[model samples]
Target: MWSQTTDKQRNLERKKEQILTEIKAVQQLLKTEKTKERNVLSEIQDQNHKIKLSQDLIRNGQQQIALINRDVEKNQAEVAVLEKELKALKEDYAKTIVKSYKSRSSQSRIMFVLSSENFAQAYKRVQYMKQYANYRKKQGDEVREKSDALAVVIKSLEEKKVRQNVLLREAEVQKKNLEAERTKQQGLMALIQKDQRKYNDQIKKKRTETAAIDKQIQQLIREAIAEANRKAREAREAAAKAAGKKTGEKVVESSKGSNTAVFELTPEGKVVANSFKANQGRLPWPVSKGYISLRYGDQPHPVQKHLTIHNSGVEISTVVGTRARSVFQGEVLQVQVLSGNNKAVLIQHGDYITVYQNLSDVYVKKGDKVTLKQEIGVVNTNASGQTVLKFLLSHNTTIHNPQSWLSGSN
Candidate 1:
């Protein structure tokens, strides 16, 4: 139970550290936003994220404190038991020492052996004296061991108390910070509410624009899949002709009008796809530092609560001028320009494709083979000054939640 509690506390500490780091990142991003023309909605969302992280840090600290308290109680109990045992051992040893001292004289020991009736009785008496001496030594050793154990338990209890106090102080500080952030968030919300209609319209317009971009991305992926399949079919037909088989016509007919929902992966493509699948939940983030400001799928608007916002991918908020990197090694299949002159890079890993969008500048072109974490482009800082990378993962035309594939904390 003690070890289990320690493990749990350690895990909480690690989680607390991660939360603190994310909170710092969010604060930095907020500072950056403050320097630029403030986008109220974005600021509110960032504030909300900061508040959530602060709450998590406080909660984690509380759990750690709870675990420490548990351990402290357990250690105190153990110390008490050891103290009792050591006291009894010392008392017994003292009594034994006094009794042995009374028979300490060499003449008394000789007399004890002489009093025996026969040789066997004398031998037995000798054995008893030796055994008593050994018992006294063993008792002394046990007393020392118990003393050491009690000291250790007492020290552990003291340390746990210290840790508990530290965590309580941290929690208090976090609570104060959380309260301040909540007040700030409310003020931002009030600002939005004052112009609620205008913000709502803006949000709706943004959602519509996002929808259009998502549609274009979907169409581009579908076309890419079709083109890949067409190339594969041509390759097969050419191979058949080279082998002197009249199978080119059959090959071409077989691929006609086939739904381009899935890629016709070659052997090499299959290997890459398998490797990508194997690394699900372990892939590196496309950027070195960021947090997911908007998650995948549908979520209510941060400020306009009644409005629903659908995202085809996660929006990661990061520092401006951050270079977007590839999550895995793959061939760049396409680099298409989206609305607002923002560009999207699609890299194919077998049947799977990973998209990095909202890039301001491209670093690699089509057919370029990029290594893991290779910088593909510069992330765009929009007119509002928020630098967000819209990242998406898909198996051919079907989108998957990128968060599920990303490693560790956002």
Candidate 2:
């Protein structure tokens, strides 16, 4: 029972620490200045992060309060049991004292033995007196022991109550903070709605930039697949020629009218591809902790209901300077630096490709081997002061939803 209570306390501490970290992250974001002029879009993004962190903190506070309540209840029950036991012990001890006092005289004890009819009877009478004295002594000791235990339990119960009260107060404070942040977010949204046209224009411009990035990524995947197939074909031809066999011309199949195509790999590449595919949904997250700001595929804009946004991958929002890591063990295929966007790292795990974009700098380069969860680069804090990573997954040339591949939860 004590171990379980201790475990709960430890878990509560961890959750509290996590809440603190998120609060700090929000504060950090607030401190950062957007690279571009302040606009509704940027303001909305910043406020959205603040609102998210506040909500998370509120949840943590709720959990903490619940844990404290359980502890308080357990301690109260323990106190009650101890009090009852102590009371019974005290009564038993008092009864023994009263009975002993009634026969307290040494002379009376001697008379009790002398009154026996025979020597054997007298000896038994003396032993009975001694046993009674011992019983009384034992009862007194037990009462003392139980009294001490009750005192300890009472102290513990008091402490638990104090802790519960503190937690309740903290939870109330967190609720207030969450409410305030939510109100602020609502105000920001209303302002954006007031200038709906401007907001829609900004969203359109962002969508255009996103489309451009997706195009570049798809093109890169296609080129890499073509190159891998070429190498494999050459290797096959060399082996055939060495065996004195006729090398018939065979062309790799292409997927026409599609941006993606299958990658033909050498024997070694096939093994890597197989391993990558086997992991599937078990892949680690690119960032240590973050939430998905934009999910894969087309979705309505947050501010403009009529506007639809297309995304090739999930956009994860994290604290500034958060390092983006490799989801799986792979070799870096390319390190691309966009005109406005910072940089992007493309990694190949067999025929599968993972892209990490919106990086401020690169820690790994082209052809460099990376291990699973290895830091690839730091995520960029954009002009709007939003630190986000645009992550994509693809097999050969076909794009896959990264959320399906990444481990569940933040």
Q: Please tell me which predicted candidate would have the highest TM-score against the true structure.
A: 1
- Candidate 2: regions farther than 4 A off: 1-9, 34-36, 119-123, 239-291, 296-300, 305-308, 318-323, 337-339, 360-364, 373-375, 395-410
The residue ranges of model 1 lying beyond 4 angstroms of the native Cα positions read 245-259
Count residue pairs with overlapping backbones in model 1.
Answer: 0
- What does the lDDT come to for candidate 1? 0.90
Q: Say what the RMSD of model 2 is.
A: 4.4
Clashing pairs in 1: none
Instruction: Give the alpha-carbon lDDT of every model.
Output: 0.90, 0.79
Please state the error at residue 63 of candidate 2 in Å.
3.1
Per-candidate TM-score against the hidden true structure: 0.95, 0.81
Model 2 residue 228 CA deviation in Å:
2.1
* Model 1 C-alpha lDDT per residue in residues 13-94, reported as the tens digit of each score: 7888888889999999888888888899999999999999998888898888878877887887898899889999999999
Candidate 2 clashes: the total is 2
